[model samples]
Target: MTASNDIDALAAMLLVRELESALSAREDCGFQLLSSGQEAVAVGVAAALLAQDQLLCSGRSIAPALARGLDPGRVMAELIGRASGPCLGRGGRGHLSQPSAGFFGAHAVVAGNLSIAAGVALALQARLDRSIAVCLFGDGACGAGALHETMNIAALWQLPLLLVCDNNLYSVSTPRAAALAPQRLSDLAAPFGIKACTVDGMDVRSVRGAAVALTDHVRSGGGPAFLECVSRRFASHSTSARETRGQQELAADRELDPITRLEKALLLEGALSTQTALGLREQVRARVTAACAFAEASPLPVPDEAFADVG
Candidate 1:
């Protein structure tokens, strides 16, 4: 990787870590930290997308928003329920939306954004816009009818869409083996005639390469594509749940942690020095500290404003 790419990867990893740290320390509100294990998927996919392209993120994933350049302070503010947040403190971390950054929003319901993404793709096609729509979801969402219906329609209409599935093996404590029928989740796209592939989500470069190729195809008027990234969830599904995986499994997953892998790769390639890496991490932590301060000092939204944006 080039120096710039190495820097981007480092920044992405730092952002994920800092966000998790901030979320973990918050005591005022209960917020979920779902981006810990899935940072590479977000950074890789976001790197391959154009600035004008739209992103529809799943509920558990907000790393993409940060990768796309959303303000860290605002993101932290949102998670902490401050009025200055991206969602005016109403949606919190589960429903972050920054239109200027081309992130449509993050949805809480499984596969809910799939249909929304299809509609966005259709609209983009109608306007003859070259911009594409990318939807990020998890393996659990694959079981929902909404994904199937959206995939069928996107394929039939040749919509410019990319379906990115972060298959982290377990869906809220249930092993994927127990929930999914097919050995490969990407196989679900075969019946719909959409080209699909699987990649190592723990390797940022692997995910980025697949994302670039698949998105290029979709941008060139090919039907939507599906990419299943086989990853592992290193943290609990939510703050309230204990780690369900055994110690052995947790250790095995940590062995392939994306942040660690990327750091090793950069060090070996001479793209990043240990001191430089430490500095980058410290910089990110400082930013996160400031973001927390901002969130703490920001005022709460007035009760009268609750129904203002309802319509």
Candidate 2:
């Protein structure tokens, strides 16, 4: 039940580097740029999960997908619409999943994964398993009907689900304060009668602490809990969207970048050294490069293969 501090640090660094590589690739391909900011929320929340836990991500959850064990090259390939990528390049960057790593999948429709996560949790409950479901979505998703319904159902049934609201402040260009009436997203779950708590989304350790407690509750059959991770997205909406003007306006929010924060924590605690940090960065870069090469060298999905898995 202890937090995997080592894995958390590794995941944060790896996600950031891979994101940088993806952005560089997009830039070369004449795209505007993939998002640059938002590393803390995804990596922080993901670091809280057990290897056996399930994740339901949103379009912006590339970091979590990578940390959960998806190959960076395959992720990049998906972004570029290559046939060798996950979903055979059909799902694209946002709609991602790595079942082998317990990542259920992501949804394009806002709040679409909430209900799916509930279903997964319900199934796990029926099986009498201790595994919990982790549902991630943006602050914008909190306004959706799925959020309301899923919260009610999960709490009413006492399903073991952790609803992580990556409250990045903006749902596309509209800030949460302007679009949502209740700025505090955690309040929504209160009506559903579930335990809800908010955390400093920018700090992985804080997120890890909250996740540990919440997962423990779920393991003991304590229904569900909602965690609103209030973080910021450093990148634009995607690699092609240049209209994203929030990052500039949100510069004040970057006072605590998760990657830097974690590195400092590791260094101060003497858990790792500067040389080790550099080596880790290099290792991540090499792994990302290798993944890209793997995707490029792998054969593209065949033209007739589209219907092979659709029942």
Candidate 3:
């Protein structure tokens, strides 16, 4: 990565981190699946996408939505149930979408978006635009049959799709090892002969590098590719969910915070100075504050709006 791009990556991660931080502090934040420890997976994957490519993700979507370049204000409004939101306040946080911006949207269901992404890939394939459909799901979705069908069809038909697993080591209170049958989640793709790789989700640069290469192959008609990012989740499953982890486990996970990891890497590489790092945090905080203001300024949707977009 160039020095500029490195810093940009760092900033993007911070943007996600700060935005979630701000939202978590809100009394009306709703049931949020904050990406407190896995910002790298979202930012890294998004860095490789072109304007024409489409991205779909699971409910843990704040990082991906912001990383995909959705306006912070619009995202904030959507999360806060305001009229000016991307979905006009209908989809809420669980289903924030802006297709024109290449973010196909977020689905709260596990493995729910996999087939949808494949369907989208099929459409894009028919268009012959060289554009691909990417799905960012969690390891929890790996156990579902939707993944199996998606992979089989993607490989058999050579669909332009990129399957990304943001594995944060746990599915709610259940550890992945206890639940998932695969020794390595990426191995699931191997049966279908799809190109797959596992990378450190704590490292944004690693994710970006893998995504770029895999996306290039997918766009070039090399069929589908799977990427597994082994990451950490600092918070509970959701804001309303209980933290089932022991204090020690939470502390250890905090040590692997992707934002701090990348910031330290940039500083050590002379790509970022301490002053600039502080400035970036302040800037990100201000932007998030402005997002909150935008959301607050917009009125909540009225009862009549429930039928506004309904056909």
Candidate 4:
């Protein structure tokens, strides 16, 4: 997770540009979404994950999914309900995943993937291996009873699971303060004797550092660890939701634009030159373009797939 100066800057720049392009495509589909605002939460946490580690993400994290190696064209296609998509156009943007990239999936249901992450961990345990499951959810999901049950099981079994709560302070317009009694999402882990920490979700490096530490802790046979990343949503909750509320404006957003913040840090730290950053950004854009072309040219699922994949 500790990248050298050049690598870190390269990763930050590439991911930021990819996110920008993906969100643009999503918007072109007539869906004014809220992913650009939460870029840092994904960039930071995803930077810490190894390519082999699995991501059990929530619906709010399209940006993060792209960082974790999902194809932008396919994702955008999925968002627009196109045939060329990761889930074969079956799962839309909110349900997108690329398992080969270790992105398991994201569910629309609140806290739905918590137990599934635990199950993935259990499967790893059955193999007697040490791979980890990283679950990213919202602070609102912490209020769900499933989170509580999953916490107890994760702690009791000492599963290698890193539970990340993206505490963006809103559950589709109902603010975090209004829904949850606990001010901090990490606090929910204490009852299960799980180690927990809170990171500035808006800072990719900070989030990466915290995730690496937590990953190490879990790999060392420790129980579950909780990390609460306080982030912000720039647009409305969804394409339809934003159109309803007219976009909730918040002063908090101006403080932390994840892409800009990371770029500034790279420049301040002298990690990369403006030209080098620009080149990397172009490379990301090119890659995404190619991916989209590949996906568009790919064949669709046979009509028999429904019967084929059914258990």
lDDT of 3 by residue, 1-311 (tens): 68787788888888888888888888999888888789999999999999999999999989999999999999999998898999988888789899999999999999999999999999999989899999999999999999999999999999999999999999998999998988999999998999999999999999999999999999999999999999998889999899899999899988988888888988998889999999998998999999999999999989987678567
* Candidate 4 segments exceeding 4 Å error: 1-34, 243-252, 295-308
For each candidate in turn, give its C-alpha RMSD to the true structure in angstroms.
1.2, 2.7, 0.9, 3.0
Candidate 2, 19-76: lDDT as tens digits: 5665466433334223345566566666667777888887765666776667687777
Q: Would you estimate the TM-scores of all the predictions? A: 0.97, 0.89, 0.98, 0.87
lDDT of 4 by residue, 149-190 (tens): 999999999988889998888888787888999867888898
Between candidates 1 and 2, the one scoring higher on TM-score is 1
TM-score of 3: 0.98
1 against 3, candidate with superior TM-score: 3
Highest TM-score, which number?
A: 3
- lDDT, residue 180, candidate 4: 92
Error of 4 at 257 (Å): 0.8
**CA lDDT scores, all candidates in order:** 0.87, 0.74, 0.93, 0.74
Off by over 4 Å in 2: 1-11, 27-36, 244-250
